[model samples]
Target: MKFYKISKDSGKKIFHFNSNFIMSRVIQTDKTTNIGCMHLEEGGVIGYHQAVVPQLLLVIAGEGYVRNDKDEYFKVQSGDAVFWEKDEWHETKSDKGLTAIVIESVELNPSLFMPLKK
Candidate 1:
C-alpha cells in the first residue's frame, strides 16, 4: 500500500497540434499497469490518440468531452469516471480547464494499482 501526491506530479506533453491551451501529462507509461494524470488548461485538447492498454479516467476538476470513432461523445465533469478500452482511438476536448486522474491498470487485475514503490 502507498500514497500518491497528485499536486507534486510534473507535467509533460503527450501530443499537441493546433491545440491552443496546454495538455499536460503527469504520468505516462507501460511498465506498470497504473499510470498518470492529465491537467488541461481551458480549451485544451488531448488530440486524437490510442493506448495499447485500457485506461480509467477520473475527472478531478473541470469538465470536458470525449469523442470516439462512432461519433459518440459525452460530458465529463469532476467526479465523473470513464473507461477507455485499449486501441480505441479517442480525443478529449476540454471546454473548461480540466484536471483528471488516470488509472491504467490491468482490467482483470486491478490490485496492481497499489503503489509498490516508496
Candidate 2:
C-alpha cells in the first residue's frame, strides 16, 4: 500500500508540455499506470495529442475547455471528469487558469471486466 499527497512542488515538470502550462508527473507504476497534475495559466494551451492509452482527467480547480479531434469544444470546471480512449486526439485550454488530476493506464483492458458480467 502507498499514499501520496498532491502538491504543486511535489513532482517534476513535464518537459514536452507547452511553456505556458505546467505538468508534473506524480506517480508511475511498472509502466502500467501514471498519475499527474497539471496547471494551465490564463491563455495557456495543451497542444493536441493522441492518447497512448485510456485516460481520465479530473478537473479540481478553476475552469477550462477541452477540444476533440472533430474540433468540438467542451467547457469543464471543478469536479468535472473527462475520459479519453486510447488514440483519441484532444487538447485543452484555460482562460482563467485550471488545475487537474490526470490518470492514465496502458494495461487496462476490456478483459478485466469479463468476469464482472456474471
Candidate 3:
C-alpha cells in the first residue's frame, strides 16, 4: 500500500498553467493516473481548455466557480467534487482563493463503454 500527504506546498507549479494559478503534481502512477493539487488566488482564472482524459477535481478549501463550454457556471467549495469528461472544454476561477485536488488519467482513452444493440 502507498500513502500520500498533499499540502499546498507539496509539489511544483505546473508548466503552462495560468500565472495566477499554482498547480502541483503529487503523484503519477505507472498505469498513467496522475494526482495533483491546485491553488487559485483571488481573481485567479484558469482559461478554458480541454482535457485529453477524464478528470476529477475535488475542492478541498475556499471557494471557486467552474465554467463549461456552454458557458454554464457552477459554484464549488470545500468538499465539493467535479468531474469532467475527456475532451470537455472547461475553465475555473476563484473569487476567494481556492484549493483543490485533481486526478486524471494520462492515457489518451482510459474509459471504455459498450452500447447494447438489438
Candidate 4:
C-alpha cells in the first residue's frame, strides 16, 4: 500500500476570472475506472479484504485509521489519499466519522500526478 497527499497544499492555484482557488489533481485513467463516495459513520469500519483492483481512497472529511496486510494501523485525515495494489489486504475505520472518494482501476498511477506523503 502507498499513501499520498492530495490536499490544497499540493495543488495548483487557479486565478481564472479574477478568482483564486487551489485545485488538487487526483488521478487520470484511460482504462475502465470506478469512482464512488464512501461515508463511514461514527465507529464505522470497512472490514479487511483484498482489493479487487488497484484502489485509491481520498479522504475528503473527518479522520480515520487504515491498516494493511501487517495489521498495523495508521492515522488518516482529510486531504490524505491511500493507494492499495490489486489483491492487497487492507481495512479502514473511524471512531468518529469520515468521508472519502474511492477510485478503482487497473490503470492507476497516482505518482504521476500526486505527491507522496512523507
Candidate 5:
C-alpha cells in the first residue's frame, strides 16, 4: 500500500475568472471505474482480502488504520489516500468512526497525480 496526501495543503490554488479556490486533483481514468463511499462505525473493519483491481481509498472524514500484505497497520485520517495494486492484500479498520471514498479501476494510478505523504 502507498500513502498519499490530498489535503488542501497539497492542492493548487485557483484564481481563475475572479474565483478563488483550491483544487486537489484526485484521479483520471479512461477505463471503467467504480467509485463509492465507505462508512465505518466504531470498531468497524474491512477484512483483509485481495484487491480485484487497483484501488484507491480516500479518507474524507475521521481516522482509521490500514494494512497491506505485510500486515503492518498505518494510521490514516481525513485528506489521506491509500492505494493498493491489483491482487494486493489489504484491509481497513477504525477505532472511531470513519468515512472514505473508494475508487477502483484497471487504470487507477494515483502516483501520477497525488504527492506521496511526507
Candidate 6:
C-alpha cells in the first residue's frame, strides 16, 4: 500500500482533484487508513456522491452546509466534524469558503489513489 506524510500546509507538490467538489489532497493513505485536507472555494457546492470509503470530515475554516439524501441537513462551521460512510449519499455547500480535514479507515483491503501520478 502507499503512504503519505501529513503536513499542516498544502505545498506546491500537492495534487488538485475534482471529487464532489474541487479539492486538494494534502496527505493520502493507500492503506485502510487515509487522511486529507481540502479547500472549498466560495459559493462552492459538492454534488451528491458516495465516498469510496468511510470518512470523517472536520471543518478547519469557513462555514457551510452538509445535506444528505434523507432530507436531513446540518450547518457546518469551523471546529465541526461529520462522519461519512461508504456508499452514503451526501452533498456539501459553502456560501463563503471552506477548509476541511478528512480521515478514513477501512478494515478490509484498500486501494491506492495517488493524485497527479495517474
CA lDDT of every candidate = 0.68, 0.79, 0.78, 0.80, 0.79, 0.67
Instruction: Give me candidate 3's TM-score against the actual structure.
Output: 0.77
lDDT of 4 by residue, 56-97 (tens): 999999999999899689999999999999999888888988
- Rank the candidate models, highest lDDT first: 4, 2, 5, 3, 1, 6
TM-score of candidate 5 versus the correct structure, residues matched by position: 0.73
In TM-score terms, candidate 2 sits at: 0.77
lDDT digits (tens) for residues 17-109 of candidate 3 = 444677777888899898888988788777788977888788899999997788778898997877788999888889899999888975533
Error of 1 at 101 (Å): 0.8
Runs in model 3 lying further than 4 Å from the true structure: 1-5, 14-19, 106-118
Taking the tens digit of each residue's C-alpha lDDT, what string does model 5 give over 14-97?
Answer: 443332334455565566787666666687677777899999999999999999989689999999999999999888888997
Question: Candidate 6: minimum summed lDDT over ten consecutive residues — where?
Answer: 109-118
Ranked candidates (TM-score, high to low):
3, 2, 4, 5, 1, 6
Clashing pairs counted in every model: 1, 0, 0, 0, 0, 0
TM-score of each: 0.69, 0.77, 0.77, 0.74, 0.73, 0.67
Across 1-118, the per-residue lDDT of candidate 2 in tens digits comes to 9887566666444435344577777878888798889987788777788888997788899999997798889899998877788999889889999999888997655344333222
- In model 5, which runs have C-alpha deviations exceeding 4 angstroms? 1-30
lDDT of 1 by residue, 1-118 (tens): 9765555245555545444433344555566665567787777887777755787777889999987666777888997777778887877788778888777755623335433222
Q: Candidate 4 or 5, higher lDDT?
A: 4
Off by over 4 Å in 6: 1-21, 107-118
Candidate 3 achieves a global lDDT of 0.78
> Can you give the lDDT of residue 86 in candidate 5?
97
